[model samples]
Target: MTATVLTIAGSDSGGGAGIQADLKTVSALGAYGASVITAITAQNTRAVTAVHPVPPEVIAAQVAAVLDDIEVHAIKIGMLGGPALVDCVAEAIAGFAGAVVLDPVMVAKSGDVLLPDDAVDALARRLVPRATLLTPNLPEAARLLRDEAAGDGAAMQDQGHRLRALGAGAVLMKGGHGGGPTCTDWLVTDQGAQPFTAPRIATANTHGTGCSLSSAIAAGLAQGMALADAVGRAHLWLHGAIRAADGMRIGQGHGPVHHFHELWA
Candidate 1:
């Protein structure tokens, strides 16, 4: 059977991030993509001008409508705008039997805050525990752990442990934000901590990288790949996308990665 992955995220007019990036990554990686738009943003590669959050009821309805009929193999969640929507999503996917990959998106590439200040607690208490995989970059990991000083490798591992304490089945500590010659992502599970490393690609076209990576991992999981293998494949794909990003000149400001690079090549 063909794999199906659902993405619950906001819409990015720029098409570099959020639901747009998620769907593109899913399809490019050979999985069926479905979406539930939790919010709408008037954004571009330069900056986010406005945000209009979808009503909580509407968000719930969208999720229920999709799960009722589709046999989704994995669910990738991003940018639940506020506390109510977070609660709504948490309740809706309470009994989901498939893999759940949560990208705790706090800030956009333009530094716009996608998640509300009040919603952080709700996200931690309600959604983090339900996630099969929690993908957080350095800043996000610090925020989730409530440790503004968590940056070193040791601290990152501790943050992973803290997230597992919060109940995630596994944690992928993204190292892109960590300033180093080599980008190393640490995957912490009940079994142990494993590190995946790749050379850092220098480019400004990294706008939708976080969203794309989580969604790609979800696609791999939906296709029945093991957790470590899924993350490894996602890392390789994202690295390639970043490397190809400079060619796509989608916008004047921070551009998007070439999601269809594999196809174009």
Candidate 2:
């Protein structure tokens, strides 16, 4: 059976992150990709020029329409942009029995805050608890954990545990934003924490790494892969995507990883 995965996210005109990247990653992993755009962003590799949020009712309607018609097996959420949007999405997908991958995309690639400072509370209280997996990069984890110590791996592991306590089934604290030769991500559950480590590939085509990773995980779940297996495959796929697109350039600033890297060569 073909797996259908949904992305509830903002639209990135740059084709890097948000729904654009989510769709690409889902399709690249051989899953049918569907989307409910939560916002429309005027953005490029360098910056987000403007953001227009979709109405909460419309967002809910889209989720309803999709769930009503399609067999959605998994969901990947990103760039909700505010508390209201986050709540709407959380409420819409609350009934879903399948996997949900929440990428707490609090900031843009240029370091601009994507979510409101106050919405962090709403995200933790309303959305994080509903997620099957919460994927937060170092900066996002720091914001969620509210700790300067979150910059270290040990602190990150503890933070992941705390995040799991926030009611997530699992918490994947991404260490890509942390400085080191290897990027280490910690997956924390009630059982314990397991780390996934990979060498940091220096490349400008990293604009969609977080979105792509979560989407890949969602796709794997949709296809019925085990949770740990999905994460490992996502890590491998993203590594290849980053390396394959290293010399290939697109926009003036950070470009997108080659989602079709395998098909091209």
Scored by TM-score, the top model is 1
Query: Which one is best on lDDT?
Result: 1
Model 2, 188-214: lDDT tens digits are 888788889899988877998999999
Q: What lDDT, from 0 to 1, does candidate 1 have?
A: 0.93
Model 1 / residue 8 / CA error / Å: 0.2
Model 1 worst lDDT run, 10 consecutive residues:
147-156
* Candidate 2 TM-score, true structure as reference: 0.97
> Can you write out model 1's per-residue Cα lDDT over 197-232, one digit (the tens) per residue?
899988989999999999999999999999999999
As for candidate 2, its clashing pairs are none
lDDT of each: 0.93, 0.89
Clashes of each: 0, 0
For candidate 2, the C-alpha RMSD (Å) to the true structure equals: 1.1
